[model samples]
Target: MTDRVAIVTGGSGGIGRAVSERLAADGISVLVTFSGGSQRADDVVTAITDAGGRAVAARADVAEPAEVNALLDVAEAEFGGVDVVVNTAGIMRLSPLAQLSLDDLDAMYRVNVRGTFVVSQAAVQRLRSGGALINFSSSVVKLALPTYSAYVAGKAAVDGITRILAQEVRGRDITVNAVAPGPTATPLFLDGKPTEVVEHLAAQAPLERLGEPKDIAEAVSFLAGPARWVNGQVVYVNGGIV
Candidate 1:
C-alpha cells in the first residue's frame, strides 16, 4: 500500500486511530477525519509523521455528504487521490427493543448506517481504480446481545450495504467489505461497564481477553491492501466469539 492515499473516518481514537497509524506505517498517506476530537486526530497525525509516515488530520461529519465530500477534497489536495476509504465513524446506544428511545435509534441510524452509506457512496464514486472501501460492523449483530437492538439494527444495515456495494461496483476493481469486531478494548467498549461484566464478555471468546485496537487494525491492514480476493464479506475479527 505504499504511496497510496486513504481517508479514515472517525480517525481520532479507538479502531480508527489504530487503522490510520497502521496504514501510515505501511507507507500509505492518511487523511484522518474526526467529528469532534481535533486534538486526538492531530496527535495521530503527529505520531505518524514523527515515525516517518505521512498523515494529516481533518474534521468532517461522516453523515453529511457535503462534509464528506469536502474531506475528500482535502485528501486529494493533501495526498493526491483517495485509494482507500475506511468508514469507522459510528455511534452505539444500547437499549432493549421495547425500551429503546426513538431519538437514540435515529442518532445511531444517522451515524452508523447512514454514515457508512454516505461515505461508501462517495468512495465508490471518487475512489481510484484498485481502491478499497471498508466499513465497520459489530460482532454483536451475530451475538444478538440484549440492550443492543438499535445498534445491532444499524450495523446490520451496514452489512447489507457492504455486500450490495461490492456487486454494485463490479468491474471497477474496487473492493468493499466490513469488519466486525467483538469486545475490543477501546474506550467505546470499556466505558460504563462494570469490571465483572467486562470479564464475562471477554471470556465468552475463546481467546479469553479483550481485543486490542491493534488486533482490529491488523485485519484492516489486510483488507485495505493485499486481500484483493476478499470482497463483500463481513469478516469476523472477534477471536472466535461467534
Candidate 2:
C-alpha cells in the first residue's frame, strides 16, 4: 500500500500549487482541483507528476455538493483512499462595510464559509482513520483591515468551523485545523494592491517581508504529517504579524 492521498482544492492557485507540490514531495498522491482554471490545474498536476509523484487534476466547485462528491470519487478511485484534505480554495472581494455589496459578500460566503462546511462535512464521512482536514483562514481576521470586512467575516466563520469540526470528530482520530496566513505574495494578495501598499504590508511582518506560498505550505505540511498532537487549532503562518 502507498502512503496517504490528498485533495488540494484551489490547487491551481499560488498557495494551492505550493501545497500540492509540497505534499507530493512528502510521498502523497494528490488530486489537484480547480473551479475555473483548468489549464492552471493541469499545470500543477504536471509539475507534481514530473517530479516523480502521483497526481491528478479534477474540477470542482467546492460550494456544490455534487461536484465536490465527484471530486472525492476521483481521488478515491485513483489514489485508493483520501487521508488529507486541504481547503485552500477561496475568493476575496474587499470593501468597507459601508460600501460592501451583498452580492460580493454572498460570493465570499459561498466559497469560503459554506464551501469549507460542505467539504469538511464530506471529508469527515470519508476520510480514513488518522486523517486530517485543513482549512484556510486569514490573518485579516485579527488585523481587522478596513476594506476587508466581508472577506474577514468569512474567514472568521472558517475559524469557527475548524474548532467545532475538531470536536465533532472526537473519536475518529481525524485532525481538523486552519492555517491563518498573513500577507503573502500570491496572485490573490497582489492582484490589486499598489506597489507601495504591498511594500508597506510586507514590512509590517516581523520577518520584514511578505510570506511566500512555500512558507504557508510548510505550515500545511506540518499539520498533515508528524503533528498528530496538534489539532483543533488555527496556526498563524505569518511571521510574527499578530
Candidate 3:
C-alpha cells in the first residue's frame, strides 16, 4: 500500500485526523477532505508533512454526489488511483424518538447515510485492486441507546451498505468494512454532555475510560493494511462498552 492514495473525509476532526495520520505514516498519499474546518484540515496536512508523510487538504460535502465525485477526481489527478477511503464525515442529533423532529432526522440522514453512500460509491469507481473502504458506524448500534435512535438508524444503514458493497466489489479485491467506535473522546462525544455525565460514561466502559481517537484509527489502519481478509464487517473499538 506504499504507493496507494487515500481519501479521508472529516479529516480535520479528532478521529478522522488520527486515521489520516496513521495512513500517511504507512506511506500512503492522503487527501484530507473537510466540510467546514479548513484551517484544521490544513493543520493536519502540515503535521503529516512535518512527520515525513504526504497529505493534502480538500473541501467537500460527502452528502453531495457531485462533490464526492470531484474529490475522487482530485485525488486521482494528484496521486493516481484511489486505494483506500476512510469516511468519518458525519453529524449526530440526540433526542428520544418521541421528541425527535423531522428536520433532525433529515439532517443526520443527509450527512451520515447519504454521505457514506455517495462517497463509497465514488470511491469504488476509482478504487484499485486490493483497495479498501472504511466507513464509520458507532458503538451505539450495539448498545441500543435511547436518544440515539435516529443516529444509530443512519449508522445501521451504513453497516448494511458496507456488507452489500463488499459483495458487489468481490471480484475487484476491494474490501468494504465499517469501524464503529464507542464513546470516543472526540468533540462529538464532549458536545452537549455535562462533565459529570461524561465521567459516568467513562466508568460504564469495561476499560474504565473513554476510547481515544488513536484506538479507532489503529483499527482502521489494520483493516486498510495487511488485514485485507477482514471485509464486510463492522469492527467496534468501544472499550467493551457493549
| Full-model lDDT for every candidate | 0.93, 0.93, 0.92
lDDT of 3 by residue, 40-116 (tens): 99999999999999898999989999999999888988898789999999999899999999999999999999999
Over the full model, what C-alpha lDDT does candidate 3 score relative to the true structure? 0.92
What are the candidates' C-alpha RMSDs? 0.9, 1.0, 1.1
Q: Which stretches of candidate 1 lie over 4 Å from their true place?
A: none
Question: Which candidate, 2 or 3, has the higher TM-score?
Answer: 2
Q: Model 2, which residues run further than 4 Å from truth? A: none
TM-score of each: 0.98, 0.98, 0.97
lDDT of 1 by residue, 81-103 (tens): 99999999888877789999999
Please state the error at residue 121 of candidate 2 in Å: 0.5
Number of the candidate with higher lDDT, 2 or 3? 2
**Segments in model 3 whose C-alpha atoms lie over 4 Å from true places:** none
Model 2 Cα lDDT, one tens digit per residue, 1-242: 14899999999989999999999999989999999959999999889888999999999999988898888899999988999999999999988899989999999999999999999998999999989999999999999788998899899999999999999999989999999999999989999999999999999987899999999999999999888999999999999997
Task: Please report, as a residue range, the 10-residue window in candidate 1 with the lowest summed lDDT.
Answer: 1-10
Error of 2 at 48 (Å): 0.8
Global CA lDDT computed for model 1? 0.93
